[model samples]
Target: MKEKNLLKDSSAYYENNDYYEIFSKAEDGESKVVNYLSKIAKDKIVLDAGCGTGKFLQILEDVSSKYIGIDLSFNQLVKAKIKSRKENSIFVNTNLKDTMLCSDSIDLIVSPWVLGTITDLGDRELCLQDLKRVLKPGGKIILIENEEDSEFETLRGHDKDTRTKDYNNWILNNGFKVMERFNTYFKFDSKDEARKCFLEIYGVEVASRVKSELIEHKIVLFEFVK
Candidate 1:
């Protein structure tokens, strides 16, 4: 499948009410990500890459000076618009590999739970480069990826251990400093519950395998300073 098409399909799969409700509840890592960003992003121009349905963007509305959400899915953006009524917030339908925003224009870049599913390493690198280009000196990039032992292994069909170190190395090589690297896990009531949510959002077989690997579902949040 084409890269863009894969993204679109993924978005469509998560576009259902079940997934949206799961996200809205902040039952996953969304709340933790939002809380961390809100603490450090006060009065800054924030860019939310792959800002699906503006869930994290909504959390930054009051905390950030300005917020721009960019995602590849128009349907997700539509849902975001319905959820957030803030006129100051802008949601743009654009690929992260190529953003319309200019260079050195943003203060903070936040990407939550996005890097893992982007199987195209080149596209992921391009997106990071675009983020770096648009960020001002001394800016920050808050990225969240799935923990190596998390359910995300099945969702993305890739292991985090394979490319996570390289991703961090790339950030350091590109002039960003890693400030904090920690593993955070979220627990569901049962494997079945987790599997159901995963299946509704991703697919069936993947969800089944992911559930089998669940000791406790979790993700890793990486905070970088540029």
Candidate 2:
């Protein structure tokens, strides 16, 4: 019943035999962020706030004019460094809520799967403020977050995607605009992997009914023009 410190780093799970077995090939959620960032990151200085395992490192570095990946996890940053080869791409270990970057210095700031940690709109506002501080005026910030989840996400600990309605209200109140929305997946190569993931996240009874097929993951994108 022990839980991984998701906030600590992906390597924790990546190293765990059981956790890794279940999730090793569990999903392609990262592609959604990379796909979007790759399109607009050309020759732009892009910031990946929660760049887990440096998943976006290769593509962003190739497409971006300059890329900076930051995360609180030292382990994750290590992996990021290994994936990046260009002098233009660098990884920093720092908290997204606050950073040392100078004001209006970055051209593009992309934060994906980070805000879901904030359960409160007020708290989310503070996070946005920090990103806003460094973002150049009229620059773009693309935010990716999970929508309301169903019971299928049972094994998840406190990390279930925050309620969608609350997030929607927060966006509306803050005057951010939706640029795109879509349904994606946490895909598994096989049923066994899916079953293990379900069991690890939800437990035995929940895993019992989990189909081998990929599970649907709903995501929304918000584009804030500063």
Candidate 3:
């Protein structure tokens, strides 16, 4: 799908209470991410790329000196605006492939499940390049991507297992060092329950078959520093 159409469809697709409830259940994931970041330092500017509904931004509120969120979905940004009323928090609608943020100005960048949606490998690379350009030297990047060997097959989209691995390597090659890697598994009681939850968050018919396979699947959390 074209990027604009995909963003519009996704915004309309997730405008339901069921989707928000399922997403709220996953808020613990944000906590886990925040805990990991807390060890880094307190005095730093942070950016949450693809900050869907601003769930993770809440976790970073008390930790960072400044927090900014950027996403492509207008609907998601509206939700984020409602949740973040802090003066230091800002949300912008911009694509990661081309950002207006100043170069080498940010101290840390966090992107949970953001990279997986870019269906084009070239665009993914450009996104990474843009991220690198915007990060200061020795700055950290915490990212999470669906695990290749996991049961979540449909989430893989046109980008295959090799592509994800290549993207990981690209981060290292561009000027970042891999500091840590964590593999997390998400569980559901059964295929029906899993399907219900995913449909609510990601829209129905997007990953029905994959939901069945992802009854227990893995995601990778990567901590890197430039």
In order, what lDDT does every prediction score? 0.66, 0.68, 0.65
Candidate 3 structure quality by residue, lDDT tens digits, 66-93: 8889888777777887888579688888
TM-score, model 2 to reference? 0.77
Off by over 4 Å in 1: 1-26, 151-178, 181-193, 209-215
Which residue pairs show collisions in model 1? none
**lDDT tens digits, residues 1-226, model 2?**
4443343433344334244333524555447656876788888888887676665577778988888898766776776688788986778787676778888988888876676555555655776788888899888888776556632344343235545566665765665788887677777878787887777744576667667557766677788888
Q: What TM-score would you give candidate 1 relative to the actual structure?
A: 0.75
Total backbone collisions for each predicted model: 0, 4, 0
- Which ranking of candidates, highest lDDT first? 2, 1, 3
Worst 10 residues of 1 by lDDT: 1-10
Clashes of 3: 0
Residue 184 lDDT (model 2): 70
TM-score (all chains, Cα) for each model: 0.75, 0.77, 0.72
Candidate 3 has a TM-score of 0.72
